[model samples]
Target chain A: SQTIHQWPATLVQPVGSPLSLECTVEGTSNPNLYWYRQAAGRGLQLLFYSVGIGQISSEVPQNLSASRPQDRQFILSSKKLLLSDSGFYLCAWSVRGPTEAFFGQGTRLTVV
Target chain B: GESVGLHLPTLSVQEGDNSIINCAYSNSASDYFIWYKQESGKGPQFIIDIRSNMDKRQGQRVTVLLNKTVKHLSLQIAATQPGDSAVYFCADSYSGSARQLTFGSGTQLTVLP
Candidate 1:
């Protein structure tokens, strides 16, 4: 069975501070990884997705960025955090083929 | 420009009654669709999925109906329970890119005893 792990289940960061959230998958290789930001009632917004290492496709322009350092390791980062950046960040992974993606526990970041 | 939208923002249902949540998509190329349920302060969980080729699919206590002609999708929960109370979202995808899904604004379902 495959499992996804996300760190810092909750974080409280100051405004303009740097942000880093990590997500990793086990029991699978070359999986498709995605980062999504979900706001109250706004739904899930796709921030970034990577089909392979060093290949990231940004869905929307924002203060956040994503990277795929290893086959199953994905990181979401920001040089500076904004008040609007605070939300539920989710990490998901799917097999290379047609399959539903599985999400992690998610990180609740609050920028004060 | 692909977009998915739900028909309602909130739905209140009585316990033991069936609940129906509806969604609509603007992308005609979308062939695959999925339904997810999310509780408060939690990530969305996969509930059920249906392909365009099929009109309906069933899970343990849930059913998903897809109407390609009208570009509408619906999730049906039978014998609704309090545990079933959550925000439900519908996602759509196409053939070439099956990994990424376009999600719709969720519908919050509240089960009342």
Candidate 2:
């Protein structure tokens, strides 16, 4: 079975501070990775997705960026944090083919 | 997708009654759809999925009905339970981009006990 692991379940960062959230997949290779941000009581907004290593597709222009360094390792980063950047960040992975995507526990970031 | 922050459409159903959630998409090329359930402070979980090839699919206690002509989908849950109260999301994907799912605005289901 495949499972996704995400770090820093919760974080409190100051304004203009850097942010780094990591997600790793186990028992799967070359999986499609995606990063999404969901505001309180709002639908999810796709931030970035990667089909392969070193390839990232950004959905919406924002203060955040994503990168896939390894086959099953994806990272979401930001040079400076904004008050609006705080939300529930989720990491998900699906197989190359048609299948259900599994999500991690997610990171609750609060920018004060 | 449009944002409905803090004011998502909600459904209130009595326990033991059936519940139906509806979703609509504008993409005609989408050939796959999926339904997910999200609880408070947690990520969305896969509930069920259906392919464009089929109009309907059944799960343990859930059924997804798809209408390609109208580009709409519906999820029916039998015997609504208190635990079934959550936010339901629908996602659509095309043929070539099977893994990149574009999500629909979610509906909050509130099971009345």
Candidate 3:
């Protein structure tokens, strides 16, 4: 009965503005967290993943960064947003081994 | 390098008919494969998964087939319904330590009512 909560469900940010997106998992501890972005027709791309607190791995180099502040809390942030940063951002959690990942509702970010 | 791809970009099927979605991968080390269904403006939902040890696995109304020799994967839905209409994506990953997944482009499945 684990659930992931992500907010805000939708966001609109001005170019060069700072951005922050939060995701937390309830009913699970020490779970593997991941950040993904889906662009138009580009498919889902893995941005970052964390194995534990204060440990983050970047899959692709970009303006966005991810942090695992707590065992269940993960945050994606950017100091300055770019027009290419606009996409549907998703947060997911999985067990230690290779297993199916559970995704949150996702945040639709639009940088204008 | 891990690369996953789909055979088609779109698929249209009649309601109550069977639907099949195909995917291909380049990494021979990939031992786990999964199929996901994504609605518009929503996260992808897990439909089914298959391990390399097994060639086939079945869920409620969904089935996943894995072919290691050809590095191909497929998802089959029985008696497709309007609710089954969505974008289907297949993902692959290694077994031991590498947990990161590589996802396919996805195939839009449109169910004609």
Output the number of the DockQ-best candidate.
3
Query: What are the per-model DockQ values?
Result: 0.75, 0.69, 0.77
lDDT of 3 by residue, B1-113 (tens): 37799999999999999999999999999988899999998999999888899999999989888889999899999999999999999998896435888898999999999
**Candidate 1 lDDT by residue in tens digits, A3-101:** 999988999999999999999999999999999999989789888999999999998889998899999999999999999999999999998765688
lDDT of 2 by residue, B1-113 (tens): 33212223689999999999988887788888899999988889999999999999999999999999988889999999999999999888887664678776689999998
Span of ten consecutive residues with least summed lDDT in model 2 chain B: B1-10
Q: Chain A vs. true chain A, TM-score per candidate?
A: 0.97, 0.97, 0.98
**Please, what are the lDDT tens digits per residue for candidate 3 over residues A18-44?**
999999999999999999999977678
Superposed on the true chain A, the predicted chain A of model 1 yields a TM-score of 0.97
Clashes of 2: 0
The sequence of per-residue lDDT tens digits that candidate 1 reaches over residues B1-113 is 37799999999999999999999999998988999999988888999998889999999989999998999999999999999999999998887664588899899999999
lDDT of 3: 0.92
Give the poorly placed runs of model 3, Cα more than 4 Å off.
Answer: none
The superposed Cα distance between candidate 2 and the true structure at residue B50, in angstroms, equals: 0.4
TM-score for candidate 2, residues paired by index:
0.94
Classify candidate 1 by CAPRI docking class. Answer: medium
**Which sequence of candidate numbers ranks them by TM-score, best first?**
3, 1, 2
